[model samples]
Target: MPVKLAQSSFRDRTQEFQSVAERLRKSFSSGPGQNGPSSNTSRAEEQRSVVAHQSEFNRRASKIGFGIHQTSQKLSNGQENFSF
Candidate 1:
């Protein structure tokens, strides 16, 4: 016998897997940086700036990808709702 899967089940699993992958990618990508801290004040400021930049980039990229994914999913559903 052939195996079968529900649509919602596949979508939920794939989304969860993708989310975990993204988190791992982000964590590993942010490696150590050079330019040691000159002083506590300056170090703290630099760290904040770095975090802000990374967050902004991640937000923008996620937004774009999410929009595209939504569109593709709608199209894939055959543009019809069949209920019984």
Candidate 2:
């Protein structure tokens, strides 16, 4: 059997995946190998900022691969609806 979900629910799940990726990136940046916990860590901060930038890039890339990037649409009633 195949798993299925409502469109909105799927959107929520994708958002969760992005959140997890973000958290993992943060954890990776803060780990012992990346930088020390003391002193000015400007380079580490720059790398962290890069990761933050790439995270959205990765998320949109995945969303496009998963065919879920069109989850946002305007309804006839002038409200937003996500359905496919």
Cα lDDT of model 2 by residue, 31-50, tens digit = 45555554237667888999
lDDT, candidate 1, 1-84, per-residue tens: 998965663234888889999988875676445333455567688999999999999999999999999999998786567554
RMSDs, each prediction? 23.2, 23.2
lDDT of each: 0.79, 0.69
**What TM-score would each prediction reach against the true structure?**
0.45, 0.32
The top-ranked prediction according to lDDT is 1
Name every residue pair that clashes in candidate 1: none
What ranges in model 2 sit over 4 Å off? 1-40, 68-84
Among these predicted structures, which one has the highest TM-score? 1
